[model samples]
Target: MAQREAFAGIMLENENMTIAPGAAEDDRLDYFVHKDGLTFAGTHLIIDLWGGEGLNDADLIETTLRRAIDVAGATLLHFHIHAFEPDGLSGVAVLAESHISFHSWPERDYMALDIFMCGKTDPYKAIPILREAFKPETLQLNEIKRGIVS
Candidate 1:
């Protein structure tokens, strides 16, 4: 006997809905949307920040996460953060409705961030918050819309 498929939809049928390999994951967050006949679809953002003071490791990470949640319209559920004191390398995964995650490093003055949001959640709004949080001398961002093949 063959296993039967559960949900049916172009969004789920496509590889677009699946999260990328080696990407950040947040087990605490589970997004559910049932409206407009569309469910389990959303956007993800990857941000790279450069140029910030190397001394203040804890402050930058805390401030960045808070701003991303409060301003980006992302509902943070839970998070895990690891930082290298001398090198100023920080990694964080923020469990959220849109999705989870952001990272920062004060020593090298660099960071990589990813934010995923579904349903009515808007990820772009978080930009200003990030801008204020990192105050990077140079910032590069990549946005990917996750849903549907066609």
Candidate 2:
């Protein structure tokens, strides 16, 4: 069985594995990006989809997220989703660069999303894919360059 660790109401489950001496592992500095004389940790995008379709469809949402992740050049580590009691859902895709997460309210035809990526990954590339898949009537987007260094 895998081991579970808990902190602040959040739990992380990990599989049992042994490391080889010569194995390549734990490299994160390579994930940072440098652009236009500035170095930053990642690009974070806040997206809101109002009056959208298929927000309640878990399979379509997952497929769309996978397609967006692939198109954005981000490596997906794991993906998980949960459906609510009535008509809502939430999901997260943990990626090598960062993560893409969202919560949907099907009754309201709305969705909130956060897409963040680091290193050589382009988070903006996911926008079009998401827009096409969700088909929102009103879309709002904002961007932040996280961990900037002068």
Candidate 3:
């Protein structure tokens, strides 16, 4: 299926969403990521999934959140999700780096997500994992670099 992928500050289609062959599965994050010649706090990503599949599935949402956290090398402190009447859910996975929060509108096949991580851990690494899991027809992302001290 054709899908959109967005991260950092760029947008690409399926081409950018694939986990490259021979890619290292684990990242050795011994320190926080320093950005642009400064002491950077972290990266924050705002993600939107339109026309996505399984937006109403709370179980799938929780599972995907866990998987994304692992792939991004973030530490999970706590996880909670609440499914609502009709068809929708809101959840969050608290992480040492930050958090990944989810709010789904199954009525419109849309999902919104927030991913933020501190240190050398690669927040960018989680994008593809989410693309593969949600299979959204259109994906949009915006990135913000948090806490930079020159």
Candidate 4:
């Protein structure tokens, strides 16, 4: 007996199910196959901000986070911010979708930020908020998709 799996007009037998180099495009499997068709899971943004001002202010950090949550279309649950010994701030904004967090190094004029959101929220929308708040001369950004789909 032979087992078979079919996807996007491509049929595969258990013994010879290898995918050819261009099979995905030919069969259109990329269109229909995903983690789950029903959910997008979420997006995580890792941001590095450099040469920014006001990085040490806890009040400013918290306010910026609040604005970021609003811009990202994520619901805020709670928030906490702490100022460091000399001149730094750490903050977290808990959201219904996920969270946004940051740690600042005022001495170097740098800040590390994380923004994670799920569901229908658009995490990328927070970029403008961060830019306006930090005024970074240089920025590095990385995006990652999160969640497991069956």
Best by lDDT: 2
Q: Higher lDDT: candidate 1 or 2?
A: 2
Rank all candidate structures by their TM-score, best first, as comma-separated numbers.
2, 3, 4, 1
For model 3, how does the per-residue alpha-carbon lDDT over 34-133 read when each residue is reduced to its tens digit? Answer: 7668676678899999998889988888888888888888889999998899889998898877788989999988999999899656778888888888
Candidate 2, pairs of clashing residues: none
TM-score of 3: 0.76
User: C-alpha displacement of 66 in model 3, angstroms?
Assistant: 0.7
Q: How many backbone clashes does candidate 4 have?
A: 0
lDDT of 4 by residue, 1-150 (tens): 132333444544578254433244454322211333543457789999999978887777888888888877889988988887977888888887788988989998899999988766787888888889879999899987765454
Q: Report the C-alpha lDDT of model 2 over 43-130, residue by residue, as the tens digit.
A: 8999999999899999999999999999999999999999998889999999989899999998888999999999888888898998
Tens-digit lDDT track of model 1 for 93-130:
44446555545555566777787777556678878777
- Using TM-score as the measure, which candidate wins? 2
Off by over 4 Å in 4: 1-40, 148-150
True-structure lDDT of candidate 3:
0.81
Error of 1 at 59 (Å): 3.0
Model 3: how far residue 59 lies from native, Å: 1.1
